[model samples]
Target: MSNEVVLRGRIVTGSMDIADGVIAADAGRVTYSGPASEYRGKAGPATDNILLPGLVDLHCHGANGSDFSDGSADGARSAARYLHSRGTTTLLASLVTGSPANLVRNLSVLRTLTAEGLIAGSHLEGPFLAAGQCGAHDPSLLLEPDPALVTELLEAAGPSLASMTLAAELPGASGLVELLAPRGIIPSLGHTAAHTAAAAGFLEHAAAALSAPSNPTGRFRPTVTHLFNAMPALHHRSPGPVSASLSAARAGNAVVELIADGVHLAPETVKLVFDLVGAENIALVTDSMAATGLQDGAYQLGSLAVTVDHGVARVDSTGAIAGGTATLLDVVRTTVAAGVPLQDAVLSATAVPAAVLGLSSQAGDLRAGLPADVVVVGPGLTLAGVLRRGEWVAALAPTA
Candidate 1:
């Protein structure tokens, strides 16, 4: 059968590009795009939906009754299906810090999934993080980066090792940054108790790599994760590492992740983050747990038990907000409801995250030659339909 499939709707793509149209895809990639009238071949029936690029969530701990922290194949598979409904075409199974052996097991499971196309790769979000500022992560498991351990992980994960999270506050972190820099394993800054000077030092590492004398990698500083959710809150006078992170984004080198569910961040704070980092440098993430897409109830976050009351998940034992129960789609809707421009809100979920992971030129765009992954939103700005690999996954039309 031909890989080509044609979809018709209001095509909303890029940060500032939106068109009333139809988009054609072949061999799991977009081949042509233009006004709906321009599509002469068979077209999926039009609806009030707005076609968009599939979302890329680069920082999620888990979802749909699964926590990637556990590294369970069943959990990862369950999470993947849950995310599919919310328009996520690509995702990283973000694992929290744990025993060394435990992490290896998780990596083994993910490598298998990657071979099966259920996941893109692994994003290790702990061990190298600062224990002092550890958010929902288990403090006992956090540690400074050990080069040998990093190598072990790479081997365990094999070709599926995509990225890892680090805190600039830790000593030797810059060296750790150097170690991963050449391996295509992106080093992101997160859960750091680093001050402004320390954060800037990390920026220099990324900036030096992207320099041209006149233009620098200031725009490509390693990513700053869950911007205001973990580490430290932005203080006007202190600014802290979080502030430095926003500053780097202005130069265009870094992308910031935000849990846009209105609980992890205030609607006002969400607006403030966009004001500081622009839509192109922001990636809207759900940071959800297994509770997401399901009713609010009890769930597991690794070894820690969690409770979800009113859609907010908290570690049952410590009462700390464990993770979110909202999917990436809910986050986009929440941003729009909070008054973020629809265009920027869309980019945060799609292009920005892909760019941060260095997958932009390939996975993030809705333009021709981009992957056939696409989604359609309704006039209400809610998820109305979805397209994955040039095929319809869901649609708001009378028939899918």
Candidate 2:
């Protein structure tokens, strides 16, 4: 709690290696992560939890009874702390379908927070999507993507905008991807009925549109958020967008978001995902709603009311999956128990998502200049501890 704190625990972010050691940090970045004998600074103990990079959540709406779209700085900070405690230190504030005016208002607040480093910008998931696939999003707000409207959103979102979820199959969506990608705002694919033909068409268009020599600066890639949930089920006859996402990753051009909460996808299917796309291509995500890390009950995802029962969040009207109430660590445990190696599971939750988001060199691995955002889980896959900027945030410390 003082100055120049060094943490001691099992370090597991190395390449196919794990070690019991100390991690040193000053201010907010990692100073060193290695054996205690190598740390040359004031030391503190990192217990029960082993130290690893802070979990990067690529798809999560909210948790701790707070919605990022609820429009409150305090509430947003509360969600950040809740996610921080659960091993996520950085998150793109995800929003649901809303009026054009409401979306603008939410993005305005997000801009201020991101400027002050309170949150990680915003992910606009609506005002543009497929109504049939809109699980918990407002049906009234769904519409086709207009590049002009998206440009307006980009202006309102300012520079900190991280991602925008849309159906690649939409008419103007590919053009929107072209426009937004150049601004450093990631374009995510979701809430669509884009089957195989549509998915392939969208990807082809997206790749061409976004990577065109005209938009040489965009450097943005297509993404499929919350795979297997908002999108259709994989099939032997018609794989649709699912197959497209898998193929894009195989072709080295896309990243697919996996909720990994078991409810969204079968435990065994996860192995299939790894087998087809490889764990490095998978970004383990929570896609958690406000019910995450809290008791199950009724909750709101944006304006739509949803129910969380038995720890599963679902849409009441149509029984469509609403979101999740689990953290990246929870998803990691679920996948590890399902047969994924611990290192690979951790990579999916940590480095994999970071890489997909284009933050691998800056925040994913334990290297010089990377933020000291880290967590620690014990030998049996229990969350032993966590740290943000080298400060002990949460853990089940050794009682003895």
Candidate 3:
């Protein structure tokens, strides 16, 4: 007999949804996914719930009182476990700005964890950032894009460095974009005060960089990191990066990430972005930090002191919004509750992020032949269970 498990519920993938459906997994891949009535083989077990592809978070700092920049393997594992328990099967452990040496040390630590499957990859949130917009990161550590520094960090991270967030307007920014484009590492533009014209210029330059002959896969695509946060606000005359990012995404030239945790962006703004850019261009990320999944209190985000109160985390010295306190799952719930359709919201949390990381084929959907990472949730969107690679995660065991 074949080893298999069958999940029955309101099946939802990144693209579509089926009511009263069945998804079967065997040998760690989804063998079948369709209406239950159409499944001819033996059905394993069934539950009436919402079944979705396990979420993918493109930008996540830390969770469970563990910051990815803490330079400890155990701390990284704790954060990974917390994310996995919340149905985020794919996560990039994000590091904040620090000295070059500290960044390398932290990336080395996460590199080992990535090899051990604790994380999918690593995201360098900066050292190459605009000091004027360095929100939670220490502005003192911010530096201009230096090719040597970028190369060193990438070498230390090995293949585990999947993404980096930088300011598009800074001197030599386009050169950094060119360097990252052919490497399959996503070049995310953020923490900047770039105006609309400059943002668009960098987007075009980034696009051209990926078109080089050296890049065979042609998978390089730029992204807007945590759209709106850490960037200048959109104004009628002085339209900033937000407009440029939205326009790029609308034209299928870029992918934009939104925190959408109600703390990072207003509920109406979240809905408007969904309406304008649609789900395919938008990815929902938590940008969560050490304060996530913990009660309101003092916390640390990289080298800066942070305080979380009323579930919002902010930097202590500057009172800037540090990061988010919600998981990717919680972000999905918040987006859906804010009037975005559930299917669209789920796609932003799953397919969009996976696409941004160039991992859509292996993750981001519930189709046959894909990895059997799935999430089961109650009618109210409460996570009840999680499965990673066809194996049940005991941490999210369903509750009665």
**What is the per-residue lDDT of model 3 for residues 289-322, given as tens digits with 9 covering 90 to 100?**
9878888989999999999999998888999999
* Candidate 2 local lDDT, 51-104, one digit each (tens): 677888877878888888887777777777778877787777788888887788
- In lDDT terms, how accurate is model 1? 0.76
Q: Best lDDT goes to which candidate?
A: 3
* Angstrom error at residue 248, model 1: 0.6
Q: Is candidate 2 or candidate 3 better by lDDT?
A: 3
- Per-residue CA lDDT of model 1 for 1-400, tens digit only, reads 7867777777776643545688889988898877776777877666667877888888777776677878679878777766776788888878877889989999899898879876777788888888777777788777777989988988899867777788987877887776666666667878887888788777667555434343211224467768766677667777788878888887776777789998998998888888877888788887777777777777887667788899888987778788787778788889988889878898888887787666776666778888788877788767776777777774211100
Number of backbone-clashing residue pairs for each candidate, in the order shown: 7, 9, 0
Q: How accurate is candidate 3 locally (lDDT)?
A: 0.88
Q: What is the C-alpha RMSD of each candidate to the true structure, in Å?
A: 3.9, 3.6, 2.3
Q: Give the range of the ten consecutive residues with the poorest summed lDDT in model 2.
A: 391-400
Q: Record all residue pairs in model 3 with backbone atoms less than 3 Å apart, i.e. clashing.
A: none
Q: lDDT value for candidate 2?
A: 0.75
| Off by more than 4 A, model 2 | 14-16, 36-49, 208-219, 394-400
Q: Name the runs in model 1 displaced over 4 angstroms.
A: 42-46, 207-221, 394-400
